[model samples]
Every structure is written in C-alpha cells, then in structure tokens.
Target: MRSDPALIGPLLERIAAWRAGHAGLFVLGVCGAQGSGKSTLVATLAERLTQAGVAVAALSLDDLYRTHAERQALAREVHPLLATRGVPGTHDVALGLATIAALERGEAAALPRFDKAADDRVPRGEWPHAPANAQVLLLEGWCLGAKPQDTAALAAPVNDLEAREDPDGVWRVHVNAALEADYQRLFARLDRLLLLAAPGWDVVAGWREQQEAELRQIGGARVMNPAGVARFIQHYERLTRHILSEMPTRADLTVRLGPNREVLELMPGA
Candidate 1:
C-alpha cells in the first residue's frame, strides 16, 4: 500500500512539535497491530525527517528476534510455543537494549537483521550499520509499549490456538512476564510513542491475510496461506487487543484507524 499523504502530513506536524521538546537523540516508538501499516508510517516519517536534514535510523522489532537456535533452545527449555518468533518472549531484549544504548551514545553500531524466510538471523557481516550520529531513532513493532494483561485475563482462552496449545496458560503467562520485565525496560527508552490503532482485533486477520497475499505474489517463502495466517495471528491476539484497550491513553500520540485503514482520529496521550 502507498503512503497516505493526508495522514502523514498531520503526523509529521505532531512529530515536529514533539521533537522540539526533547533534545539529543530522540527515540520514537511506532506501535501497531499486524498489517496496520506501522512500517509504512515509520518509513514515510524517516524520509521526511531526512529531507529536513535530520539523521534518522529506523529499526523494526522484527529484526531483533532471537536466532533460530536460541528460539529452539527456548522451546526446549520453556514451552513448545516459544519457538514462534512473533511474541514477546521470543525477542532478544538484551540486544535491543544494547543497540539503543550504542545509538544514544553516538557510537557506530551494526544493527541485526532477521531472515524470516529462513527463520534465523543473518550473519553479522550481512547486518546493516547505523550512523554514529543519528539524531532520531524510529523503532517500530507490533507490540511495542504493550502492557501485560492481569492474571485474571489469562485464565480464559481467547481462541482455539490458546485453548489447545496453551490450555494451562503456561505460554500466555510466560509472554506476559516478558512484557512486564524486559520489554518494559526496552520501551522506557522511547521519548515519544505513536500508535496506529486498528478499528478492532476482528479486522486484524483480514489485514494480515492481505499482507501474506502480497508477499506470496512476490514469491516470499515466509508467506502463509489463509488458514496459516489465521492460526499465526492467534499468537498476537491477546497483546494486540490489550494495546488497543490500553496504549492509546499511555502513548505520547495515537492515530486511530478505521476498518478501511484510513486515519480516523488522532488522540494525544494522557
């Protein structure tokens, strides 16, 4: 999908206003549900900022996923579901923290990249280098700044995936614990967070399905079929819904989107 100038214009204005209040290496977090266009918005914003003479580096949480071997070990030690890459417990939180720290310190750092098609991280030699003097860092992710659900919320199954795979709630509890601990430390680095709020969780599967379709057209190995897409999204459903219910008020700015993915309203964080 193309970038929406109508939406980007207002967002750029707000970001400029937000940047003015902060000094020295601003960290902006862009959060959204699957297929909500977080990467598109971040890319457009980074391009605009670069044209304005700012040194910007954009990173996706997807790139910080644990290596395949690491995740396999997690699966062996933790739960079988930990083998999946999309959830909180599957990320390399320490690496994320180190990357942000290095950037803030104006040190040259090589950012890691994950090869989703291969289900592993690319070699360090293949990684991209972020400039030492970046003025702004844009970190985008599906679950960035997502708060953990309470114990009561985890007692019930949200879908068949949860009901069958996580019947005892082991996986959900593990994911929530990661959110409360390591993820919280990582998110605290954000000076401002912009959330692309989907209309509701019900639309996420359709949006993700559309994304997989596009990927398939391009012959992407990671592209999932319709049924696979449905099952895959179940891993994200709980936190995505929690962010929908919680992050709008907590984020520095939130761009609400309708079913058609058009910007509906922009709300300032509380």
Candidate 2:
C-alpha cells in the first residue's frame, strides 16, 4: 500500500530523454483507468518541472467533452448513449486537435476545462491560455492513447449496459468509429504515452466508486451512488478492459499500480 517515493524521479528522467531529441512541443500523455490518479501524476510532474524551471502545459481529455447541449442533441440524433460525457464520441476531437496545434505552433492556446459537477464545459473565455513554446505538454485522460476495438469484438456485448441498452451495437460502434478516426489523429500528436495501468477492471471499479463517495461527501452535483456507479461504469468497461490489456505493450512507458495506487511495475514499452 505504500507509494513509491522514487516514482516521479524516473519519469522525469524518461521525459528528459524524450525531449532531448524532439524538435518541439513534446506532448506526453498520462493515460490511466478511471480514478487511477492520472491528473495527480500530471500535476505532480508539472510542479516538479516548474520547480526545475521547465515550462509545461497541463491539460485533460475530460476538457474536450462536447457541450451538454451538444450531447443532448447527439442523444436525440444518434443513440441515447451519446448523451453521456465519458465516452469517446462525446468529445469534440476537432477542438482538441486545434488546441494542440496552437500550442505546438508557439501560439497561445486556451486550454479547455470541463465542470464535471455541472456535466458541461466551462465557457471558452474562462479557459486559460497556455503560453507558446512550453517545454512539455501533459494531456491526461482515461483513454488518452486508447484504440478502438475490432468490429468483430463489438458483435458481443461486454456488459449489461451494452446488452440491455445497446443490443444492436449501434452505440458501441459509434464510439469505436470515433476512436478509430479523430481520436487516433489526436493521439498521434503525443510524443510519448505513459499508461498508468490498474491491476484490473475490478480494481478500477472500486476506485471509481471511491471517487463517487468522496465527491458526494462534498455535495458534488450529479453524484451517483454505488449502484449507479456500477451501471455508469459499464459504459466504459469494454474499452477499459481493452486498454488494460493492449496499452502496456505499446505505451512509451507503463506503470502498473497496486490496489492502493502504489507503483507495482514500471516497464518501458517496446
């Protein structure tokens, strides 16, 4: 249960190595399962880098979620599942691409932020601009470098949410298609992808429920109880499993986590 005191040190080393040869704007992805502390890792890294006089831009994939109105319209037009904000199809990938482009070009890019309590993006003017030429840009998300499942893989429902709600596979297919297209393009911009892999999906579920509990303690809005957490998590279960199995082999670095979020294994990807 004890955290690895040296976790950040080695990561900074690896990032320095990546930056050594990169031409400009080293985009490092801090990808992890839900409630697995991707944001904490990025924040810690940004602080460490800043202390050492490095410029960094910190962002989150959750920030790219489409507006609540946009998602509601999608739900009416596409499938009812499109109304949820966590899935791939719910994000505005074009905005993500454009923002990253502006940062890479040494132009001020307003980093987006989503108000999870309200389940919507905060106004654009409220977004703070990241100065140009940041030495490192950290974009963390649950699915930062994830890929779509095979079409054949989608034929079977992975959980009750898929079986009972999306029996025809339409909703899941739409998510995968988005992942294959725009998500991939956005992911391609990452100079390095660091995966924070949980022990398994069960652990991820526990982590998410714990998150909900903490949020509720603070009277956070739209907070779900454990049962609701279970149902809501099913929306992400399929791809969560896919990334846990697939990303370790390909991520620039993979940090396996214990049940308590302690670092268990750190493998440099092939």
Cα-lDDT of candidate 2: 0.90
TM-scores for every predicted model: 0.96, 0.97
Over 1-270, each residue of candidate 2 has an lDDT whose tens digit, in order, gives 212466888998988888996787889998998989888888889888888888789999999999999999999999999998899999999999998888888887899999987889999999998866777899999989998888999999989999999999999999999999999999999989999999999999999999999999998888998899999999889999999999998999999899999888889999
Clashing pairs in 2: none
Query: In model 1, which regions exceed 4 Å deviation?
Result: none
Error of 1 at 136 (Å): 0.3
Query: What would the TM-score be for candidate 1 when compared with the true structure?
Result: 0.96
The models' CA-based lDDT, in order, is 0.89, 0.90
Error of 2 at 228 (Å): 1.2
Q: Please report, as a residue range, the 10-residue window in candidate 2 with the lowest summed lDDT.
A: 1-10
